[model samples]
Target: MTPRIVILGGGSVGMYTALRLQRRLRRGEAHITLIDVDSYMTYQPFLPEAAAGNLEARHVVVSLRRVLPRCTILNGVVDAIDTSRHEVEFRPHKGPPRRIGYDLLVVCPGSVSRTLPIPGLAENGIGFKTIEEAIHLRNHVLGQMDLAESTQDERIRRQALTFVFVGAGFAGVEALAELEDMAHDACRYYPSIEPADLKWYLVEATDRILPEVGPEMGMWTLEQLRHRGIDVRLRTKLESVKDGRVVLDDGSAFDTDTLVWTAGVKPNPVVARSDLPIDGKGRVRATPFLNVEGYDDVFTAGDCAAVPDLTRPGEFTAPNAQHAVRQARVMADNLLATIRGTRRRPYRHAYAGSVASLGLHKGVAQIYGVKLRGALAWLIHRTYHLTKMPTLNRKVRVLLDWTLALFFRRDITALGALTDPRREFEYAARTTAEPVAHV
Candidate 1:
């Protein structure tokens, strides 16, 4: 019987692991299967652009079946992993949970949206982690414009134009910049909606935005956003958001229909249930080789795994796409070496700086001690992600979107009603049909 290998989480780690494993293993020596909740591997870096209308939403995600033709892909969420029995449990859509046995297990279930226990947050604020949320945000932003333009009441117009975003990191900042740019462009068609009336507020409990890009860059971002008339509040916190009324910790209040939560993410909660050793944040503890400590048969990587950062003593690698992709390669190579009964190498890499987009033709990047701003940074940000995008087809589509965007006006049509198309039908059904002569 061939060595059975099962990799969990179909995000960057799972997909890249399959690709690397197929490259290393030849002639069907090992049977490999990839499992994930969704059939598509989302290129998360493009999510902000997808939400902002910079890239077509469809182009940001790659179909798992199309990319992993050689590997068996299981579509579902993994429930539990029983190392004692070499079996894993999963719950597929509309089916009872089932178990599958495997000789080698790779745990890479990615992270989930990390949220706080603030009042009404779960009920009102939307997360920005998935493609669905991205689409919803786009539609919501555009729909708000429509409401603002059509509303006769001043209060309704003000509420419709007010947009609130929490967490000033890459997700919040880029999303705000992109959506603001789109909304500003969209106002050209709505004579009643003035650009000044559109309020874009970014609330952060920190001192600056884009902390991933270092302090200097982060401060620069704060200044740039303020210059653009964005009400960016630093060292402030959200008190409550019940009933669309946003109350800040510093005694501020606002009523807006939009609230975005992109604060951060915690490791998958499943790690705590497993017998695997976990850190304070509920992440599986692993050596730099990506193998779970005390068990060579079990390996882990990506956001869910707490792989030690050899470059920085006493610190684990931060959860980011660059590290995740690089770690996957090391993980695959180490897995191959383990099967061959050879020595395995540890994973070690240094930070390579960060890049962030600020609307059109504007961005910030600091790479290897070199700082770039404006269109150059934006161009670099785009070019780099384009190269890192999963497949040639997706890369082509994303690039084409950018090329077309250069020549075409921004497309900002609010389709919020799409979220519930049956609303109109239900209302139509309830209302008595207009009396008409028999035909």
Candidate 2:
């Protein structure tokens, strides 16, 4: 009988792994089934660009059906897995739960935002993970500007103009900078709302930001942000955001309607529930070969697995897209090797470097010990990620968007109605059903 290969999640690892497997696997060699709740895989590095209207939302996501048409795509979530029985409990988007059997398993559920319990954080704070969150944030930021500009109430205007972002990691910093730039550019349209009125605050619990880049670059980036008049609160924690009132550990208090959470991410909770052996950090224990420990048939990678770093002894690869993409290649090859009875290579790659875009034409990069800043860094950031982005389809669209930006200004439209698109129709239906008064 042919082997049944089941892949869980459709992020960086799962998507690329399946993409490779489907290409290499012969007819009847193995049956590939990929399970993910979302039908599309989001290229997350461009999420800030998407949010800032640099790239269209649809362009940033690759349709799984389009890319992995050869593999079976199940639009569902894996609730549980009984490794002993070689079965996984799957909960479809809209149906009864069922168990799926497989000969070989690929666990790549990825990570969820690691949020701390601060007062009113859950209600007020939104994460920067999904494409929805990114787009919604864009609308919300622009909407807040609209509210500030139109409002006569001083307190409300103040609150509306103030934007607070917690966790100064890549996600936090990039988002803050992009949105701030957008809002500033938008101020020209709103005569009352000056750029100075927009009070942007970036709060990080640590002393530094963008730890991926070296300390010198990180410090330079910090200086650049502060120079732009952004309030950088290092060694600070969000004490609370109760009722849109922001409080900080540094004894600062303010009111802001916008609070973005980009603290960190941990392994998906479902991993723990599964039978896989997990490390202390709540990730699957993965060997250098990209297979789960003590399980030859079962493999795991990406943020959910603690993959050992061969270059740096006693260290696991950091949970990032860089490592995840590389790991997927090795995992797919090893899976094929296992089936063909061939040699399987261990997943090993030294840190390539980090590149981050601050705003339109501003960025920082450190590629192979060469540190670059400003417009040149920005170009490198776009160039590097453009190549890595899956499919020529998406790459062309992203490039077109950037090219268009060169000639045109950012589309700062706040389409908040997209959030609840059916609201108007539903309201009309409800009102029309009632008896109409004859005039």
Candidate 3:
């Protein structure tokens, strides 16, 4: 019987690892099966572009079935892992749970948005993580513009035009910048709404934003955002959001129709459900080789695993796409080495700086100790991410989208009906009589 390898999560780490393993293993040497809740893995770096309608939603996601044809792809959630029995219980998308034993288990379930217990957040706040969220946010923003334009009441108009975004990390900053740019561009279509009428706010609990790019760059980012008329509130905390009224810890209060949350992420709770050796922060305790502690047959990587950083003593690798992608390569090679009885190389890669896009033709990057800003940084950001995007087909599609965007005006059409497609049909069925009744 061939060795059965089960990999969990279809995110960057999981898909990359499976691809690497497939290339190294011969037929029947190992049977690789990948399981994920979603059929496609999202390229999170392009989420801002997707939200801004700069790239088609489909182009930013990689289909597991199309990319990993040789591997057994299961669209399911890993319900439980019984390491003693070397079996995993999986809950498929539309069926009862099933069990499959594995010779090796690779856990990379990735992370979920970390949220606070602020009032009304569960119902009012939107997260900036998945493709669905990005699309919804685009529609929602446009829909808010529609609402603001149609409303005659000053209070309702103000609420509809006001937008609040929490967190100032890369996700938050890029998302705000891109969406704000899109909204500003979209204002041309709405005769009633001027760009100045739309109030945008970025609130951060810390004094600085974009900590990944250092203080000088963070300050530059702050100045750039403020120059665009965005209210950047530092050392501020969201106290509550009750009844659509936003209350800040600094005694500021506002009513806004849009509230976006992109604070941070925590390891998937599924890791704790398993019998894996987890760290204090609820991440799988992974060695430098990306193998789980005290488990020879089990391996973990990505946001779910706390892999030690050899270059930085007493610090684990930062949970970012850069680290996740590179770790997948190293993890795959190390796993093969372990199986083949060859020397395993430790996973060690120094931080390679950061890049962030601030709307169109505006960005900031720090690469190899060299810093960049403005249009140059934006160009590099696009070039780097374009090359990093998985699969040639996706790359071409994204490039085409960008090329088309240069000539055509931004599409601000909102498809709010998508959220509830049956609403109009149901209303028509109730109000309109069937023509067949005449027969």
Candidate 4:
């Protein structure tokens, strides 16, 4: 009987592990199945570019079926993992829930946007995590511009033009920068709306932003944002966003139609439902070798697992794309070794550095004791991500997009209607009727 292996969450870790394992395992010796809520794995590092229309949204995602031809792909959400029975119950995009038993299991369910119980946030705030969110944000920003232009009321226009982004991490910073660039360039098309007319605000609860790039780089980022006319408010918290009115802890209040939330993410909630041991933070506890603690047959990694950082004693690895991609390789190798009855190597990778793009030709990077900023850093940032993007096809497409962008203006067309495409149809169905039966 062929050994059955089940991998959950077809994101960076799951895809990379399946790709590596497929190349090493003998044909017919093992059957590998990958399950994910999305059929494609998004390279999240490029999300800002995707949001800004610098790279087409489709280019940043790798199709699981295309990339892993030898491995079985199940597009579904795992409802529960019953390790006691070595079975996983999942609900597909369609049809009823089903179960699949496996000899070995790997969990890499990834993370979801971490949100707080701020008033009006659920109804008003939007997250900048998934590809859909990125695309929707692009459209939403442009739609706000349209609203501002169409309305004569100062209050309405001001609210429409005001954009508030909470969190100053890479996602929030990069997203705000890229969208501002796009919005500024798009101003040329709108005779009434000057780039300065749009108010952009970046609020952070902490004293600084972009903590991954070091304090110096973070400071530089803050300065750059402020220089671009963005109101960078640090050491501030969002008290409430009740009914489009934003209340800050610093005794400030404003009404804005756009509120972007990119604060951070928590491990997928499904991890807690599993039979595995989860840490206090709701993450699966895994050894340095990527195996679940006290379970040899189960392995976990990526944002869902608290894998001990061997390089830094008494700490788990940071939840980021860099570590997820690298850890996948080690996890696969260790799993293979376990199957082959060989010594398994512990995962050990030093912190290389960080890179972030501000906008089109602006960025900051720190790698190997080398600190770079401005255009050079931007080039390096793009080049590194281009090389890291999943397949050669996607890389070529993304490169072509950048090359075309240099020649053409930014695309600022908003497809806000796409969010509710069925609205018009439903309205028509309600308002209009087919020709009544003839007399």
TM-score of each: 0.96, 0.97, 0.97, 0.97
Segments of candidate 1 deviating more than 4 angstroms? 431-439
Relative to the true structure, how large is the alpha-carbon lDDT of every model?
Answer: 0.88, 0.93, 0.93, 0.92
TM-score of 2: 0.97
Distance from true location, Cα of 47 in model 1, Å: 0.9
User: Which tens-of-lDDT digit does each residue in 1-439 have in candidate 2?
Assistant: 9899999999999999999999999888999999998999999999999999999999999999999988999998889989999999999989899999999999999999998889999999999999999999999999998898899999999999999999888999999999988888999989898888999999999999999888999999999999988999999999999999999999999999999999999998889889899989899999999989999999999999999999999998988889989999999999999999999999999989999999989999998999999999999999989999999999999999989999998888899999999999888988896677899
Q: Mark the 10 consecutive residues where model 3 has the least summed lDDT.
A: 430-439
Residues 118-194 of candidate 3: C-alpha lDDT, one tens digit per residue: 88999889999899999999999999999999989999999999999999999999999999999999999999999
lDDT of 2 at 323: 92
* lDDT of candidate 4 over 1-439, digit per residue (tens): 7889999989999999999999999988789999999899999999999999999999999999998999999987899999899999989999999999998899999999899999888999999889999999999999999988888899999999999999999899999999999899889988899989999999999999999888898899889999999999999989899899999999999999989999988889889888899999889999999999999999999998999999899999988888999999999998888788899999988888999999989999999778899999999999998989998999999999999988988888899999999999888888865745778
Candidate 2, position 10, lDDT: 97
- Where's the lowest-lDDT run of ten residues in candidate 4? 429-438
